[model samples]
Target: MYIPDIYKNENQEEIQNFIHENSFAILVNQTDGKLWATHIPLILDKNEAGKDILVGHVSKENPQAGSFSENAEVLAIFSGPHTYVSSSWYDHENVPTWNYLAAHIYGKVKVLNHDEAVGSLKKLVDKYEKKSKTPLRVEDLSKKTMMQACGIIAFEIEITSVEAVKKLSQNRDKKNYDNIISELENIGDLNSKQMADEMRKNK
Candidate 1:
């Protein structure tokens, strides 16, 4: 994550909130001299010591899961809305650029035991199922369905570093920034609209 000083975001609360909202992240690791990445939902949590951590699991079938061990370093990338910022949006001459928000979390992995793994799975299910018309609980699953849990490897990532980046055209002058937001909203796509909103908040 090579971030310029102007784009670097040091606000801890904002960074954590962004991570939670974009919980589905790319988990990156290396094994056998090969790099691997897995996309999964990682829940934000706190360990017994009250330090922030991430709880998640990967399918045992995923080759990336083969490298999990105590203190293995991993990187989780959480991405948010982004859109192309055409140079035309600027008041003066400038090159086109992309505006987006993202967070990179570097941490050490801690594999969970069987019981702890299942508990984490249960919590994961409960959180996503909460808004369902007929919410389902992990306990509601039959023994055969529950057997699927055995096929996953749960782990916790003790957060060691967080690099938060929000390149929302903060360097632009008021007129250019306002024009960019207006153009983004006029584009009418979900991502562009979201980026416009983010720019407004940042403004």
Candidate 2:
């Protein structure tokens, strides 16, 4: 991820929160000299010592997972709010651009078997669904459902590196940033509102 200083997000906690908030991410790897990508929901596990680990699964039919080579690097892209910005929204004449937030996590790939996969499923459910809500009991699932889900392969990626970019009009002057926020607020798109809110927080 190429991030300018103004748009760089260096806070580890903030980056993890962003990934958790937008858990569905694009897993990218190389296969036979070709780049392969699969969209899946991933969870970041924070151990008691505060170490972060990546957990997720892909369908057995999805050949993307088969492409991972030992020591090969994989990238998971977690995308947040994004929207186009019109030059007209700026106080002065400027080229139009897009504002967005994204995180790129690089890790070493390791496939997990049935037992580990089951544990991964449990962790996923626990992370996303609130503990207070009635959780979906995997053991209670029918054999058909269990077999069907178990067929999907699961893996853990030990994140060796990570980067995040928060390009929410950070390069713009305060006046222009404020103008952009005002314009975004009136557009009524949820993404625009999110961008506006991000800009406001940075201000």
lDDT (Cα) of model 2: 0.85
- Across 1-203, the per-residue lDDT of candidate 1 in tens digits comes to 99999999999999989987899999999865788889999999999999999999999888777787622999999999999999998878989999999999999999898899988988888889888999888888899988888998999999999999999998899999999999999999999999999999998
> Which numbered prediction scores highest in lDDT against the true structure?
1
What TM-score goes with each of the models?
Answer: 0.97, 0.90
> Tens-digit lDDT track for model 2 on 1-203?
67778888999889988998999999998876788899999999853457687889988777776676533689999999999999998767889999999999999877888988988887787776676568776667787887876677788888889999998887788888888999999997899999899889878
Determine the backbone clash count of candidate 1.
Answer: 0
User: What TM value does model 1 have?
Assistant: 0.97
Off by more than 4 A, model 1: none
Clashing residue pairs, backbone N/CA/C < 3 A, model 1: none
Alpha-carbon deviation at 40 in model 2, angstroms: 0.2
Model number with the top TM-score: 1
